[model samples]
Target: MAKYHRIIMNGESYYREYRYGSDSYGEMLSEEELVHMLLEEVVDEEIEISEREIESALRRIPDREDRYLLQNYIRCLERVGRE
Candidate 1:
């Protein structure tokens, strides 16, 4: 059986299957997850991404473990005075 999760988009709500792409190396339905992972790597690299871009992506994600992880990441940046 497949599982699903509720997430928000454009102020509305929708039920999404987080593992819809599992047949493809555990890929999932959350584009945000993939992008978030990429950004996570970026955060550890020499790449430079604007805070606005990070926040904009953050707003697209609903409250979940990954979201919170990313949030905490940004919070750490803030604590270190990112701006």
Candidate 2:
């Protein structure tokens, strides 16, 4: 069975999901510790693409208007970070 545990630390409330058998031997973690553990689970990879392949893909964009629109959208995002 699964259980929901609510922890209040430094006036902030945080919830953790605990699976009985799986987490039985584990100690509860503080909010920052839990965040760090979650981040450590992410895998980062690097991919390489050829210049010819990049040009070919860009060529498939159909029209200059669409390309310009995409460029404008990218510029707007650079000016303002995602909310």
Candidate 3:
């Protein structure tokens, strides 16, 4: 038998238990939190885009603020499985 627990941090729920003898698991998150985490961790340059591509794209986007705003939107779309 096993027991599991959960906790919320920064407005997101996280599991506090682990299951042995398996290689699968799942969790849940609010849209806001999911977007934040995915932007911060899940989707980094190493995940898909190469450094050269990122550099090229960065050069094409002139405004720093606009670039950042677009990046945030991209993260949101990715988290929602649209990208």
lDDT of each: 0.67, 0.68, 0.63
Clash number for every model?
A: 0, 0, 0
Better of 1 and 2 by TM-score: 2
Sorted on TM-score, best first, the list reads 2, 1, 3
Residue-wise lDDT of candidate 2 within 1-83, one digit each (tens)?
33557778889866576777776434566677766776666647657857587557666898989877876776687689655
Model 2 TM-score is 0.43
Show model 2 residue runs off by greater than 4 Å: 1-4, 9-17, 22-25, 43-67, 76-80
TM-score of each: 0.32, 0.43, 0.30
* Stretches of model 3 off by over 4 angstroms after superposition: 1-55
Q: Tell me the lDDT of candidate 2.
A: 0.68
Evaluated with lDDT, which candidate comes out highest? 2
For candidate 1, the per-residue lDDT at 40 reads 71
Q: lDDT per residue, candidate 3, 3-81, as tens digits?
A: 2345678776665333665644446545565557657764556546575886578679989998888788867867998
